[model samples]
Target: MNPLVITVNVKSTVYCDFQLRWYPWDDPHCFLNLKVTNVPSFGLLVDGTSTVTMRPELLEEYEVVECRLQETPHPTNNLTLLVHLTRRYQYHLWTTFLPTSLLAAIGYGTLLLPLEAFAERGSMSLTTLLMFIALYTETNSSLPSTAYLKHIDVWFVFSLIFLTLVINVHLMTFLADSESAGQSVRPTPSRHLTHVSAPPFAKRVRDRMAVPKRILRMSTVLFALVFIIFTLVYFLAIV
Candidate 1:
């Protein structure tokens, strides 16, 4: 009797479970299983001779970093091909990361303004905040909502927090300056020490003004350090 040999070709769609905790920075893995069906288990066989070929245009959004075929283990009667997919981040980097970074820079820039330019600084922070809101909305709209926060979501929250704090700082300093100026003009009356009180009142006004200036300087330095640390940890460790 002569032995019979035959070759079969199969292709079909399969389901993949994706982890999106680090989305936009996430690399997901998938497996393709080719199984023999409709025959007794003893009549079917699989071997390393199986091959996986992908069309050039099959994947446009991801790069296949690794592809390996593994013979099915004893428990499972199938051939498994493991495909490691790395997300292409250029599109997201340009649309989201770059824009948020620019907004953060411009928001922080308001702090670099002259301490006396409260109006200009406040206006800039508000404008930057509005721009950031629009960007965050557009970004989130493109992605499906998830239960947990994504890596990029953390970044946006941090930026929004920083901008909100900047605006509050400006408001606090504005109120403090206005109150101090008002007090400087309307000093308390003292019959015995009227002339002698001028220097002390002037000193008091300087101290009050100094407080806001110091707050601005401290906030600028502190926020800058915080942003640097977040970037380093996010890229070097978390990512």
Candidate 2:
């Protein structure tokens, strides 16, 4: 008789089960037993996964469990391998995630630059955005095609979103600063000739010019908070 063969594919870094079953031709008169050869002569496992003698990039290790059942019309013995595989996140956390995170933090650094120096700030924002895109592509290339999202995917997506917000915030501040700078300056009446207090309307205009600065500060704080929260949530959930 030919040997039975089975194949399966895994999508996520989660626990999975693989079953090997055997049934006898005669249930009561004859029975079948099963035994698993951990270290097969043909080399059954490759780097803790059932691969063709070559280590894979993302998977780690597995576990095996066995059981038997007699309630069925045809009694059978089953050997269930409970495979516990984890995404190899150490390298990604260092190379992909760390660089992306640092770029995001540095992206906010542009906010510290002089608002009037639009060229410098705009250049920094554009560079950071490109870095994020490159890192995201590198990370994706390492991963296999899967229908569902993985833990690592969550981190990259959130990081990209944060960077996008930073760029938009800088853009808002830039426009506000430009308009304020171009406004016609109202000359103060000769203080030497007459002691005159500043008009209420003039004070209101000055106060409004400060709004953009306040928005920049608030946005910085918000970005920092969100980045920290995302980092914590992602690591905690995956680990």
Candidate 3:
């Protein structure tokens, strides 16, 4: 009797469950398992295996870092293919990180404006708040919802809160000025005829702004420090 030679070809689809806490920066190590059946170990002993995968579509999301093939010790023959992948972070960094950061800075910049710049401050903070919400919605939609907050979620939530706080500060300042104006400007009796000179307009303006100026300066410092500490914690904990 003559010995027989057989050639087999197989194409397969694999499902990888990735851990998404790190999201765009996640580098996941996954595995594929193949179970050999029917043939005994002696009958399947002589051939080597090779992979010829072209990963263009995969490369769009991740870079293939390494792959290893090994046999598991099992009653049924088991082969495990280990694959290590690093996510492509540029897209998220540009679309998500940079824009959100710039928006946050713009929101904080409103605090630096003149203490009575109600309109400009309100407009800028409101616009940035809306934009931040839209970005967070878009980003969240692209990802599967998880029970725990992701690193990106932390940034989005806190940034939204900061913008909201800025708007509240603006609103309070506006209301305070409105109330002050209502009770103010009572006519002084014949100051025009008195010899006592009135303070210059610039000096009055400076005097009126003193308390608000100090409050705004403190706000700017506190807000700036909050942002800096959050940024540092984020990078240290996540990066």
Among all candidates shown, the one with the greatest TM-score: 1
- Report the number of the highest-lDDT candidate: 1
The candidate with the higher lDDT, 2 or 3, is 3
- Whose lDDT is higher: candidate 1's or candidate 2's? 1
Model 2: ten consecutive residues of lowest lDDT: 20-29
Look at candidate 1 and tell me the lDDT of residue 168: 90
Models ranked on lDDT: 1, 3, 2
- Residue 172: error of model 3 in Å? 3.1
Clashing pairs in 1: none
Q: Residue 55 in model 3: shift from native, Å?
A: 7.6
lDDT of 2 at 22: 11
Write the residue-wise lDDT of candidate 3 on 1-239 in tens digits: 99985666668988888888887678899888876675775433212454524443367788888776654333335567778999888888899989999999999999989877778988999999998988888888987688887777888888888889878877766665555444344456884676756678677666655555666677789889999999899878865
- Model 2, 187-216: lDDT tens digits are 655658876665587675666568678878
Each prediction's number of clashing residue pairs: 0, 0, 0
Off by over 4 Å in 1: 1-13, 38-40, 47-49, 53-58, 73-77, 191-197, 200-208
CA error at residue 77 for candidate 3, angstroms: 1.9
Error of 2 at 208 (Å): 7.1
Q: Residues 60-160, candidate 1: write the lDDT tens digits.
A: 77887877777554434466778888878788889888889999989988988877899899999999999999989988998857899988788889889
Taking all chains together, each candidate's TM-score versus the true structure is: 0.83, 0.59, 0.77
